[model samples]
Target: MSRLRPEAGILPPVSSPIAQQASFGERLRALRQARKMTLQQASKETGVAQSTLSKMENNQLSPTFNLMQKLALGLGIDMPQLFAPVHEARISGRRSVTKKQQGREHLTATYEHELLATELDSKRMVPFKSRVRARHLDEFGGWVRHEGEELLLVLEGDVLVYTEEYEPLPLSEGDSTYFDSTMGHAVVSVSKDDALVLWVCVAQ
Candidate 1:
């Protein structure tokens, strides 16, 4: 599939304060306090703006996918740890399989994700199935950049991927893309049909 260029400076939509005040905010604040680090100090370490950190801690703002990845690095934890409701000590030889309706599913602004292998702890990778919702870079708010690498496979319909360094790439069902997550990126459904994708990210 050919790639297309998009207009610059797209960002994600903001979440309501009430919705932002969920367990994620509490947990993020708790993690910072536990380290006795002020938001300013943490921001320096994480490369996130101090004001943004404050908003996140106070549940006044919600993070983007790349921001979450940055927070995970700042907290010295994997991305899945940020998503986990409770921590579980890593156990060896753990195995799990989930049916179509069995995995833990949640909706963010950009996608509906079903987390895979939640039973395991300290995993080297996080795997999930996501339904793409946004149809353009404008809907994404902005390009997304994080750490590590990611693999995205189109499961249902055609998808268009945008990155900072590359033109938008279009993929039909069964096509896949693998790249460094640190490069700013976003995905949209370009076809009239719905889009489902399998996304996997390695732990940093």
Candidate 2:
């Protein structure tokens, strides 16, 4: 699987459930075509090089966190829409059920993420399960920062959370931490095995 940029690594491999619905390149192409946008127009709107956008649309390039944010903002859609297909319209009383190990998987060097409830569109909260794979800070190029607040609950083993503005905090199974997602943060497993956590990010 091709990995995303080091700062916010995540890529849906061919075997991942999310890839079954649509590849990132296919989704990008669809969105651009739906908007009647040419590659030049998309590049201008996204502040990305035209060649880069072309490569992305052709599945020859994986986006970084910064690129994803720019694409979302430029395309007038939320970040999750980059990975999951969106419903045609929003409606009331909507719900989606995900069976065990059935959530859309996005793998990264530092974390293996399973995005939950991806069938719904325009969600206020994005929930996912992550397996902490990094054991050291150097594994990440920089902190992963984004809009909104985040809640992380340790599911198994132990983790050490690092934030740009605070000392490292250790968390055990059943423990959790909530913080501003904009502060820049990363988590590493400190246990014998990789740790698991339920992470919920409140979108703005």
Candidate 3:
């Protein structure tokens, strides 16, 4: 059965106790149509075929993980949020983050951090910790940006951050700086030793 919320386009795939039996395909089709988009339009945006999407929506074909990922991204939904349980539809106004417990997502890096926050359901400020390497310096690439002004503090060791115009500024442990993040900026290790810093970015 196809179910559509007035504003929500997706449905529970199946009525399983754990997994929602909602149809990603049907939701995709309905969402596309609701957005005044054609199958061809969705295909252009998601790189999935119109026929494939049609088949999946009609339950003739089951969407693979990759297909659902593409569909979720096209629909502007987080992968996990899209497949969230029916019983727990929206987590908003339900719980609060405690001081000892902050929601976090971690990736392959040197240390721990409270990663990017949920967009609309998130707090204003986001914090991330960059830990230095003990063996050698990080293969310096550049600073990652989202939307914010950042104040970076050298929590430990030495750090050098450079903007496109000015030369790299070296800051020792306990030193800190605040700057506009619109410009192209990158961070590197100033010393042959490690460099760890705490970054607090305020959302706009």
* Candidate whose lDDT is highest: 2
lDDT of each residue in 109-137, candidate 2, tens digit only: 68887889887766788788999999998
Model 2, which residues run further than 4 Å from truth?
1-22, 47-52, 64-69
* Candidate number with the higher lDDT (1 or 3): 1
94 Cα displacement, candidate 3 (Å): 13
Give lDDT per model, in order. Answer: 0.72, 0.80, 0.53
Best by TM-score: 2
Better of 2 and 3 by TM-score: 2
lDDT of 1 by residue, 1-204 (tens): 223332122122236442442455676888788788899889988888998887777655656666776787887766655545545555667787878856655555677667787656566888889888877666655556667899999999999998778878999999999999877788899878669999999845
Could you tell me how far off, in angstroms, the CA of residue 115 lies in candidate 2 after the best superposition? 0.9
lDDT of 3 at 126: 48
Alpha-carbon deviation at 137 in model 1, angstroms: 2.1
Q: Locate the minimum summed-lDDT window of 10 residues in model 3.
A: 1-10
Candidate 2 positional error at 196, Å: 0.9
